[model samples]
Target: MEKAGLAEFNVKIVESCLVPPCLPSPRATLYLSNLDNQPLVRTDSNVLLVYEVCENVLPDPAKTIREALSKVLVYYYPVAGRLRKKEDGKLQVECTGEGVLFVEAMVDKSLSVLGDLDQLKPSFKQLLFRFPSNTAIEDVHPMVIQVNHFACGGFVVAVSFQHMVCDGRGVGQFLKGLGEMARGHVKPSIEPVWYRELLKPKNIPVHDLELTKEKIESTSDSWIPLIYKESTQMSLTLDFETVKYVKDGIMLECLDNCTTFEIVAALVWQARTRVLEIPHTQNVSIFFAVDVRRSFNPPLPNGYYGNGVVAIGAQAIAHDVINQPLSYLVNMIKKTKMSLTNEYLISIIDTDQFLLDIYSNQANIILSDWRWLGFNEVDFGSGSPVNICPIYWNENGPNISNGFVFVHSPKRKCDAFKVIVWMPPQEFNLLEIEIEAITNKYVVNGSNY
Candidate 1:
């Protein structure tokens, strides 16, 4: 097992500039919805899309993407703006049309020499632009992109977007539009919508008087922590057939219809609780983000690229979570997921109590599902990306673990997926053994790895 540290790679910047909308967009202030204004989402998220050289010899990726980004910004103008706190201590976007940061760079090594690009490495951060030292979250750009061209003509489009502006689905929609523009489309297929008022709460509660105030302040810009820890990475792959087989087996004892995410999530939560040796009398929870785009009456508009997902989780005693049958855990997750309705989401937005509970425990495990987020389908003229990966775990706080992200396997495409997790090295080794036990009990049954 290798440590998650910087690799021997260098990226030389060839060009860098701010790209405003190619056409004029409305200049106005957009108030963020209560859901989008969560202090937990006040940070930036990074992603990398690796592409091989196309045979047709298309236009330069950086130029094409830069031009396309400017065009796309005309519709998503809020993304080109800056964020600030209002008189009520809530966040809002000032549509200044100042533009986003774009950079073009050249890497010394070819994509092949980078070993397994699927597993995230700390050095991969170099693929994206580094923020200025001591820059506050509000002071950072809403979006930043770096197109790294390799010696083999392959390239990686590394991007950073503020989580407060977009979730997984929102980012996917934006990238799809960019790809469309690069391919010579005059406009995006689905028009971008920005009716944040539609998602606003009936009555916004004051956070300063609530229990969430402390949690919110901890994430504030001025309270940087002095301690840091080194994290390790691990992954487990489950192919189509094995997943189907496990789902079928679990359904026999669990609900009639269990999703792949539920089954896998259950396995992960149980294995982690067992390996961490958490006290049986204590409680453990698993939190995950669920996209609520279609949960509304008429459904959020086709192109409403905002933070439309809500974080929900299930809690249980450590003993029960680890000792119970796998089907029991699967059913627990399914029930929690099925309980989320439009009314439930609305209540969460209206009150800060729900969010405080979700983050109340530092030992909780957080998961994000990107298997169907549509990142692999984003084509920038050449073709769909060969690999898409989150550069690091940005959502976790100092007390929490690095967490897990479920992504589609680049090599297996539709038939397989990978679960990327981060933890200390010793704990990671025990986690692998626990995961292997689950695979042996459900997927292998005696088959070799």
Candidate 2:
């Protein structure tokens, strides 16, 4: 139950069944965005949230959820479908009105048994969320839900979604709506929207190939850390005050304004690239995502839910990133964000179909900011989760390689963010050393610690 001090769970899937959409409708379908089709193969979005016991009982999760979701699916019907690839190998969700995989389970323990819930490491996370089977058909269910109850009356909700169907924000919307139903709402507080076509790439697919290097996906599951063996994943939490100290120090360098993510991401990027001993002269790149929902002139629909974010790159030599002041790194990320334009977004979809390639550059890092995504609002009868997280790797394999970090707040109640990362153990240890020194050197004073 402890080695990295992570407690193991006795998982037993008592019930495994499909929750098909409630209403009957014509077979429907959705053309996924180019952004959706390009990420690696078989990358599914898996999330787990734990809620303490509730005082009320009428809104019993069992009865309330099934009844509510049966209705919620009537409108958000595509989620009940499966993914099908065309002759060109592009993906589209086939809305056959097929049911989504839903499972009920038990853990035979209390929530507190797994202490320090905030820092559930990747190895421990794999135990909660189950990935799709590798031998399953290509056309797979886009969503799966697993509900597990503990001896203390506490429970955890595990949700998984094929990445091609929706992005992080979209996942938030779905779960939040389901929560409203379980809490006795007439329907989803905010109507679900599907204007994904807005993100479709131009017919010709124009991209700046000169700046792009194609990377093929690796079929090997080398990233999985076996039980009783070393782990390939690591998770860390950074409090708000520490984050602010780092941000203020960078701002003092004459940078006008720097957001939290930009500053933190830059620091991690610099730390990983430097401590990992990447060549000082070799170019290091950080891929930062921007939510395009509001980037349009008139703006996308208020409820438009789909893949609305795109990742832009900030590339510079490692020497500059390591030697330059913090402000330099912040500015590098800022420029990348400001450069995002409608035309640029459109051009990149076809940008040599680059989204389909594997990104294997040893010095590259991908950072996704989820602080603003409303994951804290998912309140099913009980209160919100004490700790909630998104899983990057499942039973199949790692969706992304080393150097991918997901940044999100533990909850809106606290300003601190739980930064979950996937990287090589040796490199991450070096990065951790650099992080500790920098935080003491800049985030907080050594005497204060």
Candidate 3:
């Protein structure tokens, strides 16, 4: 079912309920680290997983996941608890052993009817459970999950959880736990550890760096409405050969080596800046979330599920970003990544200030590299998800200035890259050309806007 080229499908809710821990869990208050309290993690993050019909399907996928979720919650108990504010204005979880919201639904059509899953559509929002209108974040369930079984025996799992609970790697670990339980395991392979205290700023000296700390403004009061115009979302892909070619090209320019993400992010940041036609002298920033788990001396525990990511930015004048060689921008990102030292990370945590106001910077583009975030490993009894992606809607009236996610190609996930972007329509068009020029090859563009 399709209308005006948007994904259209009727999802009928079969059952909805809250599932608590199958076993008794600790009932206490869990303190959140400063990284968890950052404004970026204050909102709910939603993702959709599409699973194609399999030859040997498990009996009752929804029931299997629901039961597995309960068992998993026993370990990830904090996720089943509600968030609350302490007298000091810091947020913490009051592990009351409540529960997470789960729903079962039936879709009217097969998953294939929605066309290429790589492309995103606003109507994909229908697959998720609607949080109560005007509910405060603290009052809402920490996690929400909806399983939609399609007419063709395929199914889609939509999950929405408070970002403050965990980052991408953390969520991936939690999902793997569910997969383990669904496969008849008594418990998760890796037991969870909540050692947030280890990350708390000790008596270590805090150093101020180029990374700026700014206050985050609410959506309504932010600059989005003042400057935000129409924006669209689309996906593009670069295969293994193309990426290697680009890397070779970069080597010819500079002797420094670059990772695939560093090169692609730099190319995209430059393309976006050129398409925006910003003033030459105006500053432009490329903000990205960096995982600081390895920055610690002993490193966070293997099963530590929390917000371990901190936002950092690379800045340059618009003119330089546009006119400089791709290697120039790549070097900037490389340097920024090199700055993620344990001391720097502690300073950021000690500063007690939010790292970046994402939308406030009009000429900036925020990027996330999800190629190796372990999302591809999330599986249930049937098989691995055919497609997995973050969900973005215009419910808040398009507050994003420019956002991009670098993902694995659905077809060739091992060595290919898929870049998803949301920006003004015209700019997206020019970006395609600029990206082709950067790679010196044609890129496959998704038809869906």
Each candidate's root-mean-square deviation in Å?
Answer: 5.0, 4.4, 4.4
Q: Provide the global lDDT of candidate 3 against the true structure.
A: 0.78
- By lDDT, the better pick of 1 and 3 is 3
Error of 1 at 417 (Å): 0.6
Summarize candidate 1's per-residue lDDT along 120-229 as a digit string, tens digits: 45556678785764687568888999999988899999988888888778888899999999999989998988788888777644332323344333322221222236
Predicted candidate 3 versus true structure: per-residue lDDT over 1-449, tens digit per residue: 25432557688999999899999989999989999988778877777777887776866889999999999998899998999988888889989888999999998878876554555555566788756557876788888999999998988899888888888888888888888899889999989888788878675666566534232322112122236566656677777777777776776678878898888888888888887788887778887888888888889988988988887777788899999888899889999889888877777677676654576666777888776777777788887887777776657533355788877666436566688777666667789898887666322221111
| Clash number by candidate, in order | 0, 3, 0
List residue ranges in candidate 3 displaced over 4 A.
1-6, 130-133, 211-229, 394-399, 412-415, 441-449
By lDDT, the best candidate is 3
| Candidate 2 local lDDT, 199-274, one digit each (tens) | 6655654455333442122211123222212335556677777877877777767548888888788878877767
Residue 412, candidate 1: Cα error in Å is 5.0
Stretches off by above 4 angstroms in model 2 are 1-5, 40-42, 57-60, 117-133, 201-230, 350-352, 355-358, 394-401, 404-415, 424-427, 443-449
Off by over 4 Å in 1: 1-7, 203-228, 357-362, 393-402, 412-414, 444-449
Residue 172 local lDDT, model 1 = 88
Ranking, lDDT, top scorer first: 3, 1, 2
Report lDDT (CA) for all predictions.
0.76, 0.67, 0.78
